[model samples]
Target: MCHSQDRTPSEVGRDLVQWFLENQRDLPWRRDYSPYGVWVSEIMLQQTQVAAVVPYYLRWMKRFPDVPSLAAATEDEVLLYWEGLGYYSRARNLLKAARLVMERFGGRVPDTEADLRVLPGVGPYTASAILSLAYNRDVPVVDGNVERVAARLLDLDVSAKSPEGRREVLRAATQWLVPGKARFYNQALMELGAVICTPAHPKCLACPVAARCLALRHGTVENRPVRSPRPRWEELRVAIGVLRENGKIYIQKRPEGGLFAGLWEFPGGKALEAETPRVALVREMEEELGVRVKIVDKIGVVRHAYTRFRVTLHAYRCVPDPPGQIVRPRACAAWKWVRPSELDLFAFPAANRRLIQALRKAADAGS
Candidate 1:
């Protein structure tokens, strides 16, 4: 609604930074201020909450503390560490970037913004964060929390993801970013939004820069940072064939460079609007595995949600029609038959993990 930085930048920056120095949380990343730790923490924090990221961040640092250590890890092990975090592509890209850092940057996280931008997962925001927080570069960073603080401070109304909104927020941030004080200023601004200036029911009284917030003065704090609504979660129906023979279960690795890339999953696909899920299972097996399968029985259903889709997986127990056929993978990377007890060794999607758990429970009940 309203616009302008009515308060002095020096005054506001001092108050925010002072408050931060006293109240900032003792996060693991902040404990050392290492470039590697900052980069990993920033990537993990995207689309994830601080509380959820803490334990995962801790475990990840313990296992792969530096660029060289991470570069040496297998993709499967990286995915395993990232299992429940969701948006697994982040983890994949992070590992890719780590290897690149070793080969291209001499096993050191790049310091220049341009060099950081060339990495797989490092974008403008992430680059700025690493530069400012890790290298003590005098560059201002704009993440969700920082954007929120800027929006309320300047009463910005456009979507933060949009170009115009970004420009406006950056303008406000630069104004308040004290020279050579980027590390403390940026973190302080974000901390203010994360704690006192939250989207819902902001604690205006406790905010360090409350006197300077245009939205608070204009009585529009709740509606200051406008964001476009997320796309509706479309319901996606899928079928998976869990082929079992001689106490071994069949699983296939997904082709690389797509969703769930390189992860092991049962072969199956979506049903045509006119066909049943079982019908889809037979077709998928023939197409993906190059074998005709008879759907012997329904296994179970598992529901999982991604960023844009809510998937309902219908699993089936299937057997090759001819009892034995040459195994071939037409649409997948590889195929293998493992004992049911060995399923836990492979990294699977959350939905497939649920199916595995159910099957394990059934075997336990029968035994």
Candidate 2:
């Protein structure tokens, strides 16, 4: 941990920007340097893959279109758009930030990282990215990709899981910043880390900054950076897929406080001991939907991964002998009987998205 003040943040910023101008990848967010676009993309990118995010981003931008639109939207609406993306908290935060922008900043996004940090869910990396990219401020954006790149490039043996370790990595990355070209430099470093200096196999030879990389030169690109122990695995038994009536889906809105909040989901909960998944679905639907459903057929099973747990989603196609009127549970705000054609308007979980396709296929096949 050397704090050589000799390497000014501005000088390093300039070099990185020069590298960025020639190497930066063309991403949608890069098309326009606006805080609204940056804010949306950064929030969407949280814990989500770029490939998965592309369609969502496009659809989201089309729907909201601007900061004022997002700010004016309801929580349920925001969650609907962000459905299937997981981590509903990010959607909640986006709304909060948008409202703050409207109220505190005259509906205009802030330009400084400090002011941006005060908004909900805008942490150090997001703040830096918004400031540097949208405002051309000289700040280092150290995301997971940037962290991996920096740690391996410098061959630093620090625990990435710890606060102090993260701070050191951020400091090191900022030391390499290229001043006036903050946006390009930050995006370039991110792209290089994402495409070339990957976790499993790094194409060191193809890396532009390989000559200055201590890890590449010393043959420690793969094994240089060490992290804390892997995340603990937890198992979740989730009951899903609320099938009701003829060719209609029954969905319950999630509470606005926890994971999957505000999103529409099939009414089912965790299966208990001595309780089969089907039985659990029956009980949960009754509890959550105020309707009793008899398990007609098991659609299929789905395996989904969350940030903290692995879920085994048991999807079943059930029918109510005498359909009870759709009602919202205490945890839910509303219920909807959405036709298959209009399923796109409602937010669903990722795994359940595939399940819906399967259901449609089953219906088409007269199953």
Give me the candidate number with maximum TM-score.
1
Task: Show model 1 residue runs off by greater than 4 Å.
Answer: none
- Prediction 2 TM-score vs. true: 0.89
Question: Weakest 10 consecutive residues, lDDT, candidate 1?
Answer: 1-10
**Per-residue lDDT of model 1, residues 1-367, tens digit only:** 3387878878888888899999998899998899999999999999988999999999999999899999999998998888778788899999999999999999999999999999998899999999999988988888888888888888887877688998887877888888888899899998888888888888999887787788888887888788788898888899998997777889999898888987889889998888789988898888887888888888788899888889999999998898887678888788799998788888889899899988888879989
Which residue pairs clash in candidate 1?
A: none
TM-score of each: 0.92, 0.89
Candidate 2 on 20-71: residue-level lDDT in tens? 7777767788798778998899889989888888889989999998889999
**True-vs-predicted CA distance for residue 365, candidate 2, Å:** 1.8
